[model samples]
Target: MLLAMDRVTSYYGKTAILKDFSFGIEEGKCLCVLGRNGVGKTTLMRTIMGLTDRSIGDITIKGTEIGSSPTHVRAKLGIGYVPQGRGILSEFTVRENILLGTFARHDGRPDIPEVCLQMFPYLKANLDRRAGLLSGGQKQQLAIARALAVDPKILLLDEPTEGIQPNIVHEIGETLMTLNRKLGITLLLTEQHIRVARRLGDAFLMVDNGRVVASGPMAQLTDDVIHHYLTI
Candidate 1:
């Protein structure tokens, strides 16, 4: 497995958000985490990245235990995260924002990865522009580019398409598909749009009230299952 969590229960302060949750994604495949809002979908991604205040249970990446590791350690272990709100530094220029990802590089190279620029031509063209000035979709692209700069073995994306224009959402989905199918980067993403999940994912995990209520291959994500766990 590229990433696996065994019985992980994540807490923010004293309140538990994810309870006894376990799931895994294989190398070079995309696993879509599905659920309605406020169901701990984002918490699952944060837990894997070790951003929660505290967590119990095991998290392994490439068979290496990372549950006890710090957030930077997890990033150094080849986990790149594009947070839900597109956590780019608003005051930084595009170039500077992307440069931040290189801090996690094992090679210590500070240069922006060529793949990041190639993947998002807009960002390449506007490297000097302040990230805050970009449109919502453009900022999303920048966020993904920054994460790719980590040269990760696995990328964790939370709500990649939220609050974006429909056309841009489709574009982002296509880009992610290329990354997964051609470049062979493993992806774990939480998505509210079932259509996007169906288009991009090889596998699926359904979360509800912080637990894995249903999970299987994309083909096994039947309408019955969707209605039961995903419909609001």
Candidate 2:
């Protein structure tokens, strides 16, 4: 497994968010976490990135115990997170935002700086443009690019299709597909929209009330199951 979250548990203040959550992701596979609003899908990803307070669990990346590692340290160990909102530098140019991703790598994965351009070509053209000046789709592209700049083995994406136009959503889908197919990148995506998840994921994990309710290949997720566990 490229990434493994074993018996992961998390909390927000006094409220528990995740309860014994566990999952594994391999390189070149897309694992989609599906649930309705506020069901801890994002919390699970945040915990893996070490952004949230983990109640208990072990996060292993390529056999390295990274559950307790800091967010920046996890990034250096090949974990990239594209947050719910596109997290690009509003004032800085696109190039600068991407360059920041390469700063932490001790091993210096060559794919860090250049591969993002291959994934989202628009970023290459808009290198000189300020990230804030770009459209929502463009900003999202830049955000994904920045995360890729560090050449992460596992990419955790939170709602790539949210609040975007259909054309841009299609582009995001294609971009994600290309990354996993050609580059053998592992993807752990949290998506609310069924259409996006259907197209982008190879495996499916259904999380509800902070626990793994059901999971299997995307093909096995029937309409009835989705209506019960996923639909709002």
Candidate 3:
């Protein structure tokens, strides 16, 4: 497995969120995490990235245990996280924001910029524009571009298409598929779009109340399961 979480549990201060959640993804596959709002989807992503400290369990990337590693160490260890809301700096230019991702990463993959530009052409043209000034979709592109700048082994995305328009959402899906197929980057996506998930995911994980209620291949998404926990 390229990335694996075994019996992972997390907390927000005192309240527990995830309980013994476990999942895995290969080097070049995309694993989509699906559920309705406040279902521990974001918590799973955060826990994997060490943004929220894990109360129990283990997270291993490429066979190395990273349960205690900080966020910066995880980034250097090849985990690129694009958190919810596409948190791009509104006051900083596109190039500046992308540079932020390359900061902690010292590997210096020379082709990073080229690959990111290929995935998101809008950022190529507006390299000097302030990120906050861009449209919602453009900001999303920047957020993803920044994460890619790190040359990650696995890309962890939290609701990349949350509030974007339909056209932009489709565009994001296409980019993700291309990256997964062409660049061989494993994608762990937490999203609410079942339509998009069905199209791009090789496997799926469904959570409810911070627990892995069900998981399997996208082809195995039975109607009963979707209606039971996925649909609100």
Candidate 4:
């Protein structure tokens, strides 16, 4: 397994968010995490990256015990995260934001990977453009590009298609699919769009009230599962 969580619980401050959550994803598969708003979908991602205030239980990446490791250590272990809200620094240039990901690389090299430039031509052309000046879709592209800069074995995406233009939603979805399928990068995506999840994911985990309520191969995620756990 590329990623595994066993009875993991996470909290923000004194309040509990994810409770005894457990799931695993193979080395090259995409796992879609689904839930209604405020159901700890984001928390689950944060917990894996060691961002929560505290967490207990096992979180293994490639058979290594990372449950107690710090966030930077986890990143160096090849976990890349594109957080919710496209957490790019507005003050930085497009190139600078991408360079930040390289900090986690073991080589300690500061050069931006050529793949990042090749993947997003717009960013390559606008290397010096301030990140705050980009559109929603552009910012999202940059976010993904930054995570890719980490040269990760697995990518954790929190609502990668959120709040973007309808046409660009499809474009972003396609980009992620190419990364997961063609490039062989593993994906752990928290997504609200059923269509996107169905297209990109090999398996699904439906989280509700901070626990895994339903999970299986993508073929088994029927309309009933959608209505019960996904729909508002």
Candidate 5:
């Protein structure tokens, strides 16, 4: 498995967010986490990265136990995260923002990976532009680029297309598909859109009230499952 969460529970200052969540992702496959808003979709991503106040149970990446590791250590272990709200530094230039991901690299090199630029031409053209001046789609691209700069074996994306224009949403989806199919990068993402999930995911985990209610191959995510667990 590329990533696994075994009976994991997490808390944010005494408020329990996830309850005994268990799931796994195989290498070079995309796993889509599906749920309504506030159902701990983001929390699952945060818990895996150790951003929660406290957590219990096991989280392993590439067969190594990362349950006790800090957030930076998890990042160094090749879990690149493109968090919800597109956590880009507004004041930094596009180039500087991407360079930030290099901090987690074991090789100690600070250069932005060429793959980041090659994948996002807008970023290549606007390397010196301040990140704050970009549009929402551009910012999303920057966030992905920054994560890619880490040269991660797996990517954890939280709503990568949450509020972008429709065209850009499709574009981002295509880009992610290319990354997964061509580059063989493993992906774990939280998605509210069913079409996006079906397009990009090989497996699905349905989260409701911070727990995994149902999980299986993407084909098993029937309309009934969508109606019962995903409908708002």
Candidate 6:
């Protein structure tokens, strides 16, 4: 497995958000986490990145335990996160924002990877522009680029298409598809759009009330399962 959580229980200030949750994604595959609001989808991403207040259980990347490792260590172990809301630094220029990801690179190289620029021509053209000034869609592109700078084995994206225009959403979806399918990067994303999940994911994990309610190959995500767990 590229990433696996074995009975992980994650907490935020003593309140457990993910209760004994467990899932795994194989190398070079896309896994979509499906759930309604407040169902611990985002928490699952955070837990794997070690961003929650605390967590207990086994989280392994390539058979190595990272449950107790710090966030930076986890990043160095090849986990790239494009957080919810596109967590780019408002004060930093586009170039600076991408450079931040390189901090976790084992190579310690300060230069942004050429792949990051190649993937987003707009960002490459406006490297000196302040990140805060970009449109929501553009910021999202930057977020993915920054994550790519880490040269990760697995990418964790929390709501990668949230609050964007429909056209931009499609474009971002295509970009992600290329990353996963063409470049062989593993993807683990939380998505509200069932269409996007169905399109991108090879497998599905349905989350509800901080638990895994259903999971299997994407083919197994029948309409009955969707109606039962995903309907609002």
Expressed as tens digits, the lDDT of each residue in 1-232 for candidate 6 is 9899999999999899999999999999999999999999999999999999999999999999999999999999999999999999999999999999999998899999999999999999999999999999999999999999999999999999999999999999999999999999999999988899999999999999999999999999999999999787
Alpha-carbon runs more than 4 Å astray in model 1: none
The reply for model 5, stretches above 4 Å from the true place, is: none
Best by lDDT: 6
Clashes of each: 0, 1, 1, 0, 0, 0
Local error of candidate 6 at 49, Å? 0.8
Candidate 2 vs. true structure, TM-score? 0.94
TM-score quality measure for candidate 6: 0.99
What are the C-alpha RMSDs, in order, of all predicted structures?
Answer: 0.7, 1.7, 1.4, 0.7, 0.7, 0.7
Off by over 4 Å in 3: 106-112
Per residue, candidate 3 scores C-alpha lDDT tens digits across 1-232 of 9999899889888888998888888889999998888989998988888878446888999899998988899899988989998888889999989888886565765444688888787789889988888999888889988999888888999999999999999999998888898888899999888899999999999999889888898999888888998666
Span of 10 residues, lowest total lDDT, candidate 3: 103-112
Candidate 5 lands at a TM-score of 0.98
Give the TM-score of each candidate: 0.98, 0.94, 0.96, 0.98, 0.98, 0.99
10 residues in a row with least lDDT, candidate 5: 105-114
lDDT of each: 0.94, 0.85, 0.87, 0.94, 0.94, 0.96
User: Residue 20: error of model 3 in Å?
Assistant: 1.0
- How many clashes does the backbone of model 2 have? 1
Model 3 alpha-carbon miss at residue 227, Å: 0.8
Q: Is candidate 1 or 3 superior in TM-score? A: 1
Clashing pairs in 6: none
